[model samples]
Each structure stands twice: as structure tokens, then as C-alpha cells.
Target chain A: MEEISKSPVSDVPTLADVAARAGVSTATVSRCLNTPDRVTEKTLKTVMDAVNHLGYAPNYSARALAAGRTNMIGAIIPTMENAIFARGIQAFQEELQKNGCTLLVASSSYRQDLEEEQIRTLTARGADALLLIGYQRDPQIYEFLKKRKIPAVLTWASEPSQNFLSVGFDNRKAMKELATDVIGKGHRTIGCISADTATNDRARERVEGIWAAMRDAGLEPDTLQVVETAYSIENGEAAFQQLMSGANPPTAVMCGNDVLAVGALRAAADLGLKVPDDVAITGFDNIELAFVAPVPLTTVHVPHRRMGQLAARALIEALHGRSPESVELPTEVRHRNTL
Target chain B: MEEISKSPVSDVPTLADVAARAGVSTATVSRCLNTPDRVTEKTLKTVMDAVNHLGYAPNYSARALAAGRTNMIGAIIPTMENAIFARGIQAFQEELQKNGCTLLVASSSYRQDLEEEQIRTLTARGADALLLIGYQRDPQIYEFLKKRKIPAVLTWASEPSQNFLSVGFDNRKAMKELATDVIGKGHRTIGCISADTATNDRARERVEGIWAAMRDAGLEPDTLQVVETAYSIENGEAAFQQLMSGANPPTAVMCGNDVLAVGALRAAADLGLKVPDDVAITGFDNIELAFVAPVPLTTVHVPHRRMGQLAARALIEALHGRSPESVELPTEVRHRNTL
Candidate 1:
């Protein structure tokens, strides 16, 4: 663990040293390091032994230049601060690594402009393909990828006719099912806390799904109260407090996602109301917290790992010059103690 | 949103298109794309306009070859499935992007071998610098990074003398302080739940810190029962239940992290045991969930955002050939309803 000098002329062994130690040509050593599968087992073992003994590290830039591919993929998520996207992105990155591709990740904080900027930055740093979340984006982004010929796949929402490779569950349908279940539980009045719907199609779709289900169950859309808030516990708490302060509070609350639901649950507890007895609550995205909440949260469980694995597979297929089929994974209601 | 071919020869616009549209040399266009400051503003604007108009995207490999720096920073963490590392890494990436550097993230899944492989892949993918979560790692990884002269910063534990940059809290001391507060609250018999301590320095340090605090307060270390468990809610509940089932059960429980404490809290509620009345509980790393738990958790708050910002600044400084100082950020106890 000694400090090594920054200069290139330090005592550290170079690729030439490894080649000399392995008793092979420099090109053979280079081939072993860059394309190990192409080398014979005997040669690969010898080169790797020499590498271990001499501690020769490959020059990444030089190797990337020679190979014409960095074997890297870039994934741009909206946020990791929330667990909603973190779990799926983790699975996607693991799948990519298993296939010998490294993942470069960036967060856009739910800003379309920032996402566009990160896409360019990731591509400029030698990502062989891109994995983007959601299908809605600036049209210029699509054009940029088309002009670059970068294999890109979108996840977390599916729109087959858009022609983008999508691996996701139907967000709209998931919310509709959850809303229907709430109605079946004998809750006529429903309140909703959702992220702003103007620019976020997923949020808009979820809100509309709830409206559709409620309307179908004979509840008026106007009677279904809704509040738009940022996706954070603090915001959720504030929105819940506001909802409860209304002259007529709804008997049931449906949150766009689990984080907001957790917040609403906390708010209810703070107000000295018993969950399910005084008011029932429901959440989408059955995250880990939902299972461990004070009261197990009844939620919609999206197939996070499946969607991620499919997205990686699709992107890799696209990179290999094959058209990957889009997939719409399933979502199910997890019955728990809350509702 | 059209399905495009993978080959470079598809309908994609190449750099030649930008050159033609701008009425400039291809070399000029390349230089304008790679090093904007080197070109005149008028010519740079013209090239950018053409790039936008034709949707021309620069090739990553060619750009990395022309510019020695990749503008990519690599981070290797345990898992994103848990929220412990998510917020900090998210903040770190946000800060890095402000300086025009993208983050390349990989998860080791808490495996030493996977971590080593990920380090190699990220380095091979042209990460100019690295941000590792902990100080402990395979010796070969240290040797490889040293041989390559890559600037790396360790996080989650502070070790300044290693000559590697670090931005983290004192894990051992923070736990000791929390244990002291528990003792001060007149709780002698304590049970601890921790992740496997052998490979995880963070968990081990917290456990040892509790033992030391107990010993200092004249309590035998053996009297404080310890349970090693995975950092999951279901596992935490099982462990807590087992502890409570034992004869002479502890009056208080100390968790290695908030995730474990959360499970313990739920188990207590399920058992009809009141927190701090029947049994007291404490947690480390005060995540957002801590505040929203059924009984607000009393825990140590690590400055996640500050740690991220400092780590990014220090790593960026080191990349710029400046010696960045290591920082051991402070942690404070937040008193709530749990303990």
C-alpha cells in the first residue's frame, strides 16, 4: 500500500516487462489482457502469472484506442436518493457486468435537460450502448442517438409503437388495479398524493389510472381529491397534513409511490390515527420499506429485477445487431396489514 | 423513436456531415467537439449549430483518444438495493457532473472478488479517478491501482495516513458515542444486531465500539449479546425475536445500521413490547426512514450530502495534480422516541 509516483517513468512494471517475463511477444500479452478468450489456456495462464508477478497494469486509454470498443454501457436514472429506481438500476448494472460490459451511471434529478446532458456525456466517454428510463424525452435526444447509431433501450415504461426497446410494467394499469382494490375494500372517498404530472408521463398515467378506476366504481372524479407534490418524505408528509385538514377527509389515501405512502403513514401516526381502523392507506412500488413499515403497506409490486435484466438483454442484443423484442412485465398487488 | 440499425453506416450522421454543414474542415469540427475553448467562438457556434441540425454525435472512442482525460470517475459500492449508499452516491455524482465529469458506478454485491473484477472493468473503461466505499480491499487491487497511477479516494471510513484521499466519518467513534448515550440512559443489558463483521470494517468497527463502550462502563463484554445477521428487515426481525426469546433478555438493542434497527423496531411492535419502556433500541446512520418509523428512532446522523460533496471536490483536486486533504466528518446523536 505504498504511494506510487505519478510519473510514467516510475519503477512500476509495464506491458513490455510482462511480455518479457511471460516469454511471449508484446502483441500476445496485449491480446491476453484485452481479449483473454482469444488466447490459448496455456498462453493465458502464463501471461496472467507474469501479470501477477510483475504487477503490470494495462493502459486503459491505449487499449480502448486499439480495440475500437470500450465494452462499457451507460445508464441514466432519474434519482438514486429514492429506492424506486436504485434497485432496478442495480440489477441492470449487474447484468451488464456479467456480460463483460461496465456500467456508467448518472442521475438527472428528474430533469429532462439534465438527462439529455448526461446522455451526451456518457456517450462521449465511450459507452457502447445506453439505457434510459421512461420513453418520454426531448425529440432531439432521439435524433441525437439515431445520428450516433448508439444502441439505446428505455425502461420503467413501455410504448411498443414508439419503436424503442422497452422493458417495463404498465404503470397505468398497476395504479388502476390498486385503485380498484381500494374501492373493493369499501372505501368510497379516496385521496391521492402524486408527483407533478405536467412533464412526467408516468405520474400523469398513474393519476389518470386511479381516476379511471374510481370513476368506473361509481365515484366522481371531482370527489376524488388529489395533491401534486415532489417525491420526498417531507413533501409527502406536508401533502398528507393538508389533505387531513380539509373539511371532509377521504377515508382512503393512495400514493403515487411508496416513499410518499410512508410519509403519509407517518403523518397519520403523528395525528394519532390508527391505520386501517381510522383510515386505510395504499402505496405503489412495493419497495423494501413497504414490507417493514410499522403496518405492512398494501402496495403494487413491480418486477424491478426482471425489468432490469430484460433491459440489459435488449440493449446487448441491439448492440449485437439483433432487434430485441419489447417486454411488458407484470405487476401484482401485495396484500399486507395497511389496507 | 425509430428502430435504428447498429452499424455506423446506417442513416446516422457522421462527423463529416457536421463538417460539410459548417463549411469547415473535419479536423476543425473534431477539435471543436473535443476542445471547445481551442476553437474561435464563431466557428465553434457554427459547428455546434451544424451538429444540432444534423443530429451529429461525436464518436466516444475517437474523442477519448484525442483527449487524454476521459472525463469519467468510477465508484464501487456494496449494493444499491439498500438506501444506505444511494443518497451519498447520488450526491457525489451530482457534484461530479457540475464539473463536467460523469460517474461510472458498479456494485460488488458485498463480495470481495466481484469488487476486484469491477475495479478492473471500470479502470479499463477509462475512469480517470476512482471512489471506493471502504478502506479494506484486495491487495492486488491496491497494487493494480498503484501501478496504473490512478487517483482514488476511499469513503465510509477515514484513514488519512494511507496516503489515499478519504472523506468519511469515524465509524468506530460514532458507535462508541451512541453506546455511551445508551448507557447514560441507564440501560446496562444490551443486544446488538450487525451484518457479517469479518469483511465489513464498518460493521466490525461499530460492534467493537459498542463492546469498548460497555467495558469502559464496567459491564462485561460477554454480557452484551451479539447477533450477526444480514442487513435486511426480515432477517432483523428473526434476529430480534431470537434475542427476546432468550433468558435474561437485554433491555436495550443496538443495531449496526438503521436498516437493522428498523426491523428490530417492527419486531418489538409485533411482540406488543413498547419501545424504551419494555426495551430500548438505537440505530446508526440516521436515514430518512429512521424519522418516519412507528417510534421515531434515536440514532447517529452522518452528513451524507457533505461527505459526497467533499469526496468529489477532493478527488477532482487530486486529478488536477493537487494534494487534497482527507476529512473525517462529524456525526451527531438525534434524540427521538425510540430510545
Candidate 2:
């Protein structure tokens, strides 16, 4: 390839240029670019040849403004640093493409203000609808979306809020089941490592669910040691060390997610402690890392791909003036060697 | 939060409306939104207050068209399904934000056609500049960008082509160093697993580098067994198994990336093979997972954060009419337990 000049060329091709080259109307060129399947095979080949020869690029902004909608759906995830949300988001994007909608995704890094700003940015960029992770943002954001007539569907945690569309599993219920399984293994003393729940409803709900299970089993929920940290393997390791340093260490440790659980497993190995003999550990999210861990982790299996697919379909339906109903998916706790 | 109606409010706020309420000109409102540091503190507060009171969102399309620049940089990565590009893209986004620019990221899933489409979509959406992964793409796309005068910077793999700006490391040199280290460990028979090299320059270069190192060490490079797969842990594990099942298996296994290396380690364990004793393993890209693996991996440590930060700054400079020179960062060979 040769270096092209930075200066703008005078004869930049337009839809009209393509139309003249293909011997068709400008509308036909626009149709070929936007909805190629709608054009006849012979006309499609001619217009595409013209498009290639003239190197014409469609003006998305002009087309969006003229059409009064961009057919674009935006999603705001907490972060993409791990596999926790990757599978789900991939499914969501594929579903959106199937529905003729493009996905524009942004990461908030678990910051409420940043999320709000991204919501505005996506809306300003002409997103017809949105897919938010949780229903914990400020009321003002909802108002802004409402005023702009942008439909949004929340995911990851099921909140029975009629005011918002949601598609997710019950986080609290899933955690309770995992806790019950850990307790059923004859472990009375237990420690918990949870993600910082300040702005995360899912993490908070998971912790509460674990507490409920402990209390129901006649264990002192108040006495259960809890360490809150960022969702990382290193943090999980640090939290595990802190818990084990106490005079009366627990026999079992539960983590907020798979990333943290994998960390605990690493720490256990570093300490020369055998899993399921010296201590048992559990995790949530059942990400691929759980299976790849030195000791395969016992975790709650949330339907990530299903959540993403449902959220995309629901948002698209809502955009078409059909109110999308809330969906609650089921989760299962897998009892593995970790327990 | 209450459900807001789907209908658009007739009294939607505009920049002019904010200006009227703040007792300022529309230009002041625009400046307050785009470049808050340029506005006086008092004026900024007033303008922001007015914007909040009216629930105003600046129309990005209109603003881009009016200013002939969006102050937005778009990045088209291979995939976001794993941690391969997460750390670098995070650094890129942070650097872009610091430079008063926002980022719009899209993933191509390693498909050349999808990548080309994303480039055109981003350009048509008014991205002032672009960050492409490699130099390989349709020539017509380059022609289109040149005609539009869009500044683009390639990343992830350094190329000698002066046709474009790039910020990355020498993939071949990095891999050669790792392979040489493996050979020095008294390993003659070595098998390699790599990502499909058809559309990826980095993967192709890494494979070539390994062959170069093997041939230089008097090892028959043609005898080296190679398995090409996707850059995933599961694929790595399968590849490892296939290599091990063959007659006269290699004493050492090399992987294209850390994900594959981790998989190979897992497969070795499942097959009751010992690391460094029964067989040795090597990986590239010292991701966190490499350290957390049961046996730590010896790999090449690329400066992901530095590459991202440099790419952003250089692109911004190029957009400002300065020709940014291509940068080739250094990679280090980390000799850990696996080797």
C-alpha cells in the first residue's frame, strides 16, 4: 500500500455518483446500501460494482436523521475486563444483528456517573433503545430516557419493577441455593468474599442471600466473617488471607463471582491447603475459568447467553411499540469437588 | 423509579433553551458541554445547572456536522470475547478521555469483511479518526478514508509500511526470543499451537519467528508439529491433546497466546503429565491468567498499556495535521516455571 495524502479529494463520490455509474436512481443506490436483500440480484450486482468503483461511503448520520431512527441499540456494561459478561454480550450483539439493529457497547467500570454519561452519549448518538445492566442508576437517568422516548431493558438481576423491563435470573435465590449446598456438606463455619456492593445490586443481593441461608441453618449470620473487595483474583487472594489469619478460621469460603473464587483457589494452593479437605470454596457465574481452575469450582450456573438474547429481543420489541414483559430465568447450583 | 411515557415530550430542551435559561449565548452552552475547562467556573455552573433543569442532551450528529469534527476516535478490534484486547483497549480509552476525546469501539470477530464494514460505519458516523488493528484490509477502504481525509492509526502489530501510522511491537522478534529460550532448556522436539494465521499478521509472524528460532538451533523446522486453532483455552487444550496423542510427541509445547498455554497446562495435568519434567510448555502474552495457572507460564510480556496510550496520543496528533511516526515498543521474555 502507498501513503495517501491527508488532503481531502475534490471528487469524493456520492450516492448520485453511484447512481450515474450504475445507471439507476439515487433511491436505488440508497436501497442497495441500506437493505441489499430488497434489491433484485442483477440490480444489486450493478450497484455494488458502482459502489466498489466509485468507493462511495454511505452517510449514516444523514440517513439516520432522514429515517427518524438509527435502528441502533446501545448497551452499557459494568466492565469487559473478564469473561463474566463476554458470552452474554456476544449473544446479545448477535441477536441484535438478526433483528436488523447494530449494537454500540460501552463500559462504565461500575461508575454510576460514567454510566449516566454513557447513557446520554448513546442517546445523543441516536440509539433507538438501550440495554442497561442493573436498575440502580439515578432516577434522573430514567427521566431523561423517558423524555427522549428511548426504550431500555435491564439485565443480570431480576427486579420485579413494573416501571422497567428486566430479563435476568434471581441473584438472591441462586446464591441461597449455593449457600445451602455448602452448608449441607457439614460445614458450620463459613467465610464470604463479596464484590464491593456499593453500586452493584447483584453483589448486594448475593451477600444477603448467603446470610439468609446461614441464618436458616441455625448458624450465626452475624458472626460470619465477610470481606468486600474489587472483583479480581488478587483481591480474592488478599481477602482469603485476611480471613484465614483470624484466630478461628472458617472451614468453607464463598466468593461473589468466579474470578474471585479462582483467586481463593490460587491462595489456597499457595498456602499448601488442600481443597475439600482443609477448606471448601464456592463461586458464582460459572465462567469458563471455574472449569479451568486447578480444582474445578462449584458454582451457580446463570444462563448468560439466554439473558443476552432475551434482553436484545425484548428491547427490539419495546422499540416497536410493544411493551416488553419482565422475564425471570432459572439458575442451578453445581456441586463439584470444591465442596 | 416510575415508568416515563414512551412519547417524546414536546418541550424537549435544546442548547438554545439552556442558553436562554442561563442568560448566555448558545456558543457558551456548547463550550460548557464540550470544553468545560475553557468556560469560567461561574458560567459553567450556571450553564450546567440550566442543562440539568431542562434535561438537555447535545445532539452528537448535529454537533459533528456543524463543527466538521466529532472529537471521537473509533477502534475496531478483532474480538472482545476474551482478555486479549481488554487491557490495551482500556488504556487506549483512558488516554483518549484525557485528551478530550471519547472512544467508540467495535469488534470484528476476526472477519475481514466485518472489519471493513465497521471501518466504513464508523467513518460515516463522523469519527474524526480511527484505530485499526493491522495493515491488512481492502485497498478500497483505504482509498475511501483517504478521500474523506480521516486519520487512522494501526495497532497490535508493527509494520514497516510508511503508508500508515502504527504503534506496536515486533511480533516475530518477541516470539523468536521465547522460542530460543525454550530450545536452551534442552528441548529438541517442540510442538506449537497458534491462532489461525489466515487473517492475522501477528499470529503469522509469531509462527514464522518460532520456525526461525528452531532452524537456527539445528532443529528441523519442517519436523515441528503445528496445530492452528482459535485463541481460546478450550481450543488450546484440544490442540495439546492432539499433539500429545501423536507418536513421538514433542518434549515441549509452545502456544500462540497465554490462553492457549493455560489450556495446554490443563490438558497436561488431565493426561497425568508433569510440567518441565514430563514435558515443558511456553506461552506468549503474560496475562494475569498465566500467573494464576497451576504452573506459572514463561511467556513474552508485551507492553499493552504503553501501546494503547501511545496509539491514542499519536492519532490525536495526526488528526491535528502532524504526521505521527510509527512506534515499535519492546517486549520482554519472562522465564518462569513452565519453561
lDDT of 1: 0.84
Q: Which parts of model 1 are misplaced by more than 4 Å?
A: A1-14, A34-45, A59-68, A160-162, A186-188, B1-12, B27-45, B160-162
- Superposed on all Cα atoms, model 2 deviates from the true structure by an RMSD in Å of 4.1
lDDT of 2 by residue, B10-93 (tens): 566878889999999999998898778889999999998888777788776665555566676788888766675877877887
TM-score, model 2 to reference: 0.92
Candidate 1 TM-score to native:
0.92
> Model 1 chain B, poorest ten-residue lDDT window?
B1-10
Q: Considering chain A alone, what is the TM-score of candidate 1? A: 0.92
Native A-B interface contacts kept, per candidate: 0.54, 0.24
